[model samples]
Target: MHIVIIGVGGVGGYFGGKISNSNQKVTLIARGKHLEAIQKKGLQVKSINGDFITHPFLATDRIDIVEKADLVLICTKSWQVPEAAELVKPILKEDTIVIPLQNGADNAEKVSTVLGVKHVLGGLCRIYSKIEAPGVISHFGHQPDVVFGELDKSKTNRLQKVKEVFDQAGFNNSISGDIEVDIWSKFMFITTVSGLGALTRVTIGEMYENKGTRHVLEQTATEIYKVGIAKGVSLPEDIVDRIMTFIGKQPYESTASMQRDIMEGRPSELDNFNGFIVKEGIKAEVLTPVNTFIHSCLQPMEAKARI
Candidate 1:
């Protein structure tokens, strides 16, 4: 199968690098110094599981030349999903399968708005990795797992084919029973930590260890849970508690990708994370005061980054 990985950041780089080791053809859409480095020196993955390097069949910034793909993995930030979809639209074959393995809850929906629902799938990834340098990805923690399925949850031949590809590539992947619930479970956790972590400008340990910030964190998760429930996602009643337990087990130095983006003064998923929850809350008649506060507080920085 031919696969194109868009936005070769932490998620894309790691997974794409893994797939490159297999017999399947792989192309990576990347940008700036990262793309340059990948084209010249190959993509390097320093993984907790192991370290390896593989040069893809092609790595380019041009979306047009990647005119055909059996599968397209959208790994861009949540806010960029629609833009990415538009860029990749002409390249999609009728049978092309696109999965948004992004942090935001509505990335698949956002892509569907551009590429149509028939071409999109729901996907979420569990990994904490980042670009350590140009063309170099560092997987510092967590066993990387990619969960995905058709939006309608149908068990189809194509779905099995995608799963087989990942399995062949030696990735820990599974077809989710309920992709929506799986996406929300990830959204609830990432959104809970991201905004507060960005605002406080602290590591996860520092944010949770401080009494005041811990309260904010809890409230943030609460707001997300309320919004998810209002939106009819099958988020469990104990999701917030479960997330807290998960957070507690995380390494103290751990931080979210959105938090890192904001701290580094890059454009972030602020709109897609807290801002998304706030908007959905209003639509669902759910109160998301904590998210609203975080969104408001971070707006200036977010705006300035774009400038």
Candidate 2:
């Protein structure tokens, strides 16, 4: 399959590198110094699992150079989705599956509005990764899983084809029957974790070690889960227990990419994560005090980064 990965940051770089290493025709859409680094030295992934490099894949800043791909993985920060969708339009064909591997439940809807509903796929990635340098991506854990499916919950040949590509690349993947529910479940986990970590300036390990902070984290998760339920999403009753268990097994120093972005003075996906919860909570008539508080607290940091 001809694949184009838009925004070759942590998520894009890691996955794209893996696919490229497996001999897939992958084109990376990147810009600035990172683009230069990839062009000169190839893409590098420094992971705990192992480090590898892919030097032969195409890398370009121009969307016009990107062919009509079988799959387009939109991996930009949440704020860049609309503009990225506009940029990707000319390079898309009718059957091209555009997977929005971004945080927040609104990405698929937003991309569908621009790229047409049939062409968009809802996806979430689980990985602790970052662009450690201009041409380098650092993956700290073993959580490299990609979950995606059709927006309408139908099993199609295209879905299976995409899964085949991922499987060939030796990556973990799953096709969900209810993509919206999957997106919400991931959003619930990410927003709560990012908000709490950013607010406290602590890693997942530090938060888990402190009973007070852990309580706050649980309360935050409950608030977000309630908002999801109020919006008519039937999240599992044991979601808190599941999330806690999952988090406990993670390395204590593990942090969300959003928290890392905030700490690095880079723009975050706050609007999509906590900000989305606040917007949806208002519409669903759900009181999300914890979400609201964290969203407000992070607003200044995001604003300052822009200036």
Compared with the true structure, model 1 gives a TM-score of 0.97
lDDT of 1 by residue, 99-188 (tens): 999899999998898999998889999999999999999999889999998888788788898998899899899998889988998898
Residue-by-residue lDDT tens digits, candidate 2, 1-307: 8988998998999998888889999999999999999999999999887899997368999988677888999999989999998988988887888999978888998998998898998999988888899999998886699999988788888899999889987789999998888888888778878988988889988988789988877887888888888877778898877887777777878889889889889889888889888998899898988889999999999999989
Off by over 4 Å in 2: none
Off by over 4 Å in 1: none
Could you tell me how far off, in angstroms, the CA of residue 90 lies in candidate 2 after the best superposition?
A: 0.9
Clashes of each: 0, 1
> Looking at candidate 2, what is the lDDT of residue 72?
91
